[model samples]
Target: MGKNFTYLLGMLITIIIGTILYFNLCSDCIAGSSNNEVEQVVTEQATAPEPEPTSYPFAIANGDFDYSAEDNFNFDLSSANLRLPVSEKVDFGIYKLKDYLAENAGKVINITGLYSSKEANNTAFPNLGLARANDVKNYLVKLGIPSSQTNTFGQLKDELLPLDGVLLGPVNFNLADKAEDESETIAALLEKIKTNPLIVYFETGEASINLSAEQRQKVADISQYLDKVDGAKCLVIGHTDNTGSRATNISLAKDRADFVKSYLVRNGILENTIESSSKGPDSPIATNDTEEGRALNRRVEVTLN
Candidate 1:
């Protein structure tokens, strides 16, 4: 009985050993399967696609063309209003506006807003619409804008202030005393000269008035006033120094007289009333021997028609 029991015990031990070996192999096989699964994962990862980078509408900065504002990437530049697409709005100062307008010449553009003098920065800006417009026209002509086509009209004329009171300092001339219409005043002023009430002169003529801005502006104001006066007419006369031949000097003097007449005529003053005559170097306001005297002798006289 003892021998049979011992033999059974040995068989039991072998069975136990076989069970342990089977479990060890099964556990090791499952762990090995997970390792193989890792290989499949790595293969899929190697074949996977990559994400694309951001792009832009136009050619972004490549160092060829520079940018005005730094850090373009931070802002949402998709909106048209927010992003400055062109160089149109760029300004170094207020004069650039005039420069731009002048460069464009006759091209009609909108000029808006009231630019005030004494604002420190915008003080030098023209206060009068016509003056500003004229300045713009002149500027554009200088900028190569064809002078023929250039015409400017102000949208907001009332907003402008008088330049004389501020930037130009106080206006000395009596703008009111001068006739409102230029043609009429030019006529009256010339006629006044015939009686010698209003003195006329060359660079240093017998006219006591200095050819300063005060004097010229007064003339201009009178010219404007004459344009407003009723029954206003322009009378222009020509004069010359006695130093030259009488016939030649008379002809030359007439030409000189006509030149002033022509300026008013071209600028909308009636030519019919603006009669031209040359007093040969015969009318000597001063002696013809000296250069100064000769200069004084070259004169144009105007009278009402």
Candidate 2:
């Protein structure tokens, strides 16, 4: 009986050991399979494709030109066109503008035609603004930029805060669509001449004003004012020094005054408003004996009344 009980206990111990070994082996196999799966996932992730970098089409938009912004990125044509006194036909700096536009052809552009109320307090201000905008648009169109790509705004009244005025007072420019439209007021016209006087000087024995490229601007400035100011009376007074014969001086002075008047009328100034007069050797601001004085005296003054 004792031997039978011991044998039975041994058999039970062996069976327990076998069961424990079988469970441990199955656990190890499961663990190894899980590790292999984890390594495969890591390898796949390491060989995965990466996203590409970003790109821009306007890398060469500014071209080879350099530009400075006084306020923001709005390119100023004022330096080339608006700051100077303008005539019916004046030098509008269009060439440099064209170069810039051509370089940025694919991009859209905005042109703000800036005007001042103090300088251009006439009904013609709006027209002037529109014309300037149109000028830029037309130029860009000619340079292969589509007309639809350009947006133009003409502001007759400066909306800038803190009064950012340039070159003193206002700048006026106009492009009239109709012939009979009277747009500028007398007060505005008088103010224009008072702020910016138009004085044409004459060479000795010459009655005609110089029409050179530089002088053309001066003439245009006066003519533009006259054109805008309808029925605006002007005293076109010519003066000469006591150098030549009194009668000859008088004739020269009269001729000079008349020539200026004719030029004004030809450039859109009304004929009846301009009163041509000569003050030969009479109104001497300086001594007529000196060449400097003579040069000063040999001048045609246009005063708006």
Number of the top TM-score candidate: 2
Q: Tell me each candidate's TM-score.
A: 0.34, 0.36
Residue 216 in model 1: shift from native, Å?
3.3
| Model 1 ranges with Cα > 4 A deviation | 1-212, 221-231, 302-305
Give the per-residue lDDT of model 1 (tens digit) for 117-160: 33321111122332334333333334443333333332332222
Model 1 misses residue 16 by how many Å? 70
lDDT of 1 at 303: 46
Tens-digit lDDT string for candidate 2 (21-103) = 99999899999999999999999999997543221111111345433222211112242133323221112233343455555
Off by over 4 Å in 2: 1-189, 192-196, 211-231
